[model samples]
Target: MNEALVRATIPQDLVKVLGVEPRTDSQAEAFTRSFLKNGIQPNSRTDLNSMLSHKAVVLGYARPKKDKSKTKSKRAKGLNARQKRAMKIFHIKPEHQRYELFLPLHELWRQYIIDLCNGLKPSCSPQFVQQKLLKADFHGAILTVIRSKCPSHVGTTGILVQEFKHIFKIITKEDRLKVIPKRNSVFAVEVNGFVSHIYGSRFEQRASERSAKKFKTRGTIDL
Candidate 1:
C-alpha cells in the first residue's frame, strides 16, 4: 500500500491497537498526526494488520502486572532484533498525558523500568531512546530541555546508564555502565537557564497557557 493510504488508515488501526478511542474526528486526526510525525511506521496494510492481530493474541495471554518489591529472575541484558522491532511499534496511550502529549523524564523512566521488569527489552542506545521517547508521544521540546539541563550527559551511554540507575534502583552500577556508547565527548555547552525559568516542563507551561485562554474564552462567551 502507498504511504498515503497507510497513513489514512492508521487512525482506525490505532483505535484497535490502543483501547481508548478518540471522541471526535478532530481528536482522532490530531492523534494520528502525532503518531505519523513521530516514528510510528505503518509499513503496509497487511503487515500492520498482522502486527495488530499478533498484539491482540499477545494481550489475551499477557501476564499480570509485576510488583516492584518482588524479586524476579533476570533475563538477558540486551534486546534481540525481534524484541527491538516490537518496542518500536508498541502503541499505548501514555497515562500521564491525558491532559497533554508530554511527560517528565522521571515518569517515563519509571514506566520504562516497570516494563523492563515485565520482560520488555528497552533500547539502551541514546539515539534509540530519543526515537522511542518521540514515538511514545513525548513532545520534542523535551530534547531541548534535556540537552540544556544535562549538556555533559547528552548522547553519552554512561550518563544514560547513570540516569536510569538513579531513577530505577534495579540495575547495578557496573551493569549499567557496561553498555558503552560509540561517542563520549562533552561538546559545546549550550547552557541555558530556560529549564530553571519554568516551574515545570515546557509542555506543562504550554498546556497551562492553553487552558487559561480556553477558560477565558468560555467565560467571555457566557458573559
Candidate 2:
C-alpha cells in the first residue's frame, strides 16, 4: 500500500480502536501526531500490524459535577401556624359533650392504669405507683377537682377529654365540657379502690412531656 494511504488508514483505525471521534481537524491531527510520536511506523505491513497490536488509549470529556449546596433536603415542620389556628378555632360542641359518650374511653384508661401498675397489687410499692401515675395518660380518667384556688372549680367531676400544656378539658356528667386550669388545683382518681391525689400545681405539662420527665418528691406543698 502507499505510505499516504497507510497513514490515513492508521489514524481512522486509531479513531475506531480508541473509541474517540475528534470533533475538529486540529484535534484529529493532534491525536495522529501523538500516535506517531510513540515510534510505531505505519509504512510497512509488519510495522502497521505492530502499531495496531498495541493497547488502545481512550479519550473522553469528564462528566459535569453536581453542586451539593444547591440540593434542598426535606425537613419536618410539625404543627404549622394555620394548623395551630385551626385547632384553636375548632372544638367539641356542647351537644356532643356527654358523659356516656366517653364511658368507653374511661374503661380503656382504667385498663391502661391497671396494666401500667401491674394489676395494682398490694405488694406494689407506693413509690412505684406514684411514679407510674406521674407519667400516666389521663385522657380517659375520671378526675374530680377536690381542691382548687377557685371556689367554683371545687367538687367538679368529669371525664378528661383533651390534656393541653396547662389545662385539662373534661366532659362533665351534665354534658358540659369544662376547661380546668392545672395551676393551684388538686385532683383525685381511684384505681381498684386505691385513691390517688394529683397536685395540679406541679402537674402543668403536656402528657407526652410528662412521660419522659423525672419528678422529685416534695415533703409538703401548700396548695
| lDDT of all predictions | 0.33, 0.83
* Residue-level lDDT tens digits of model 2 in 1-223: 7878855543776888888764667877676667655655556444444544685545467889998877767675688758987887547876778899999999999999999999999999777787788898999999999989998999999999999888999989898888899998999998898888888877888899989997776553321
Runs of candidate 2 exceeding 4 Å displacement: 1-71, 74-76, 87-90, 217-223
lDDT of 2 at 28: 75
Candidate 1 residue-pair clash tally: 0
Candidate 1: stretches off by over 4 Å = 1-79, 87-141, 144-223
Q: Judged by lDDT against the true structure, how good is candidate 2? A: 0.83
Worst 10 residues of 2 by lDDT: 43-52
The TM-score of predicted model 2 comes to 0.67
Best prediction by lDDT? 2
Candidate 1 at residue 92, lDDT? 31
In the predicted model 1, the residue pairs found to clash are none
